[model samples]
Target: MTTPQDAIAARRKLTNRLIAGKDARRLAPFLASDVKVIAGDGSLILGAADVLAAFAGQFADPDFVAYVRTTTGVELDAEGARAAERGTWVGTWRTAGPQSGAYLAVWRKVTGQWLIESELFVTLG
Candidate 1:
C-alpha cells in the first residue's frame, strides 16, 4: 500500500506530466466533475467542462509551456486522500509576456483516484 506521502508525490508527478505533455484532455481523469477553478484574473468558474475549455487553447499551443519552480505541498486529509499543492509556476506564450504566479490546488480522492476539486492562482508581479 502507498503511504500518504507517496500519494502526495504522485500528485506532483501527475501535474508535471500534464504540463510537460501539454495534455489538457488528460487532466479530466484527475479532476472531479464539479471542479471549481479560480483564475488569476479573479474569475470564478465551476464544472470541469468549463474549466477545461478555458484552458484547452493554451494546452494545445505548442509554444505555450509552464514550468514549476518548486514541488511543495501538504496533505489535507490524514489518509492522504485530500491534498493541497502550492508553488510558483511560470508560463510563457508566443503573444503575451511570460507570466509567473503562485498556484494552490486542492485535490480530493474519489474512488481511489486523486482528483482536483479546486484550484486557485494568483499572479506575482
Candidate 2:
C-alpha cells in the first residue's frame, strides 16, 4: 500500500520525466488519443499525433535545445486525484533564438496512472 505522500512524490518524479524525457519520446504514452493542445499563441492543436508530427522536425534539429529550470508550487488534491504543478522552462533554438517561459500543468490520475490533462504557459524574460 502506498501512502499519499509517497504517491505524490512518485507523481512528481514522473512529471519530471515527462518534462525532460528523451527527445520528448516519453510523452507519447501519456497523451490521450484525442489530446488537444492549445498553444500559448492561442492556436488550437488537435490530437496528440498531430502535435507530435508538428514537432518532429524541431526535435530533430541538433541546435534546438530545451530545459526545464525549476518546478515549484505543486498542489496535489488527493481527494480529487488531481494535481497542479508550476514550473519554468528555457529553450534555445539556433534559428529561433532563446525563450523562457513559466507554465502551469494540470494532471489527473486516470486508471492508476498520472497523465497531463492540460497545460498553459506564458513567455517571460
* Residue 31 local lDDT, model 2: 59
List the lowest-lDDT window of 10 residues for candidate 1: 66-75
The true-versus-predicted C-alpha distance at residue 62 of model 2, in Å, is 3.3
Off by over 4 Å in 2: 1-24
What residue pairs clash in candidate 2, if any at all? none
Assess the local accuracy of residue 110 in candidate 1 as a C-alpha lDDT between 0 and 100.
89
TM-score of each: 0.80, 0.70
CA lDDT scores, all candidates in order: 0.75, 0.64
lDDT, model 2: 0.64
Q: Candidate 1: global Cα-lDDT?
A: 0.75
Task: Write candidate 2's Cα lDDT for 1-125 as tens digits.
Answer: 97544564566566455554535666566655666666556677677777666455556777765545356666888586887767776766667867877877666777887666766667775
Tens digit per residue, CA lDDT, model 1, 72-103 = 65656666678887777676777778887888
Weakest ten-residue segment in model 2 by summed lDDT? 15-24
Count the clashes in each prediction. 0, 0
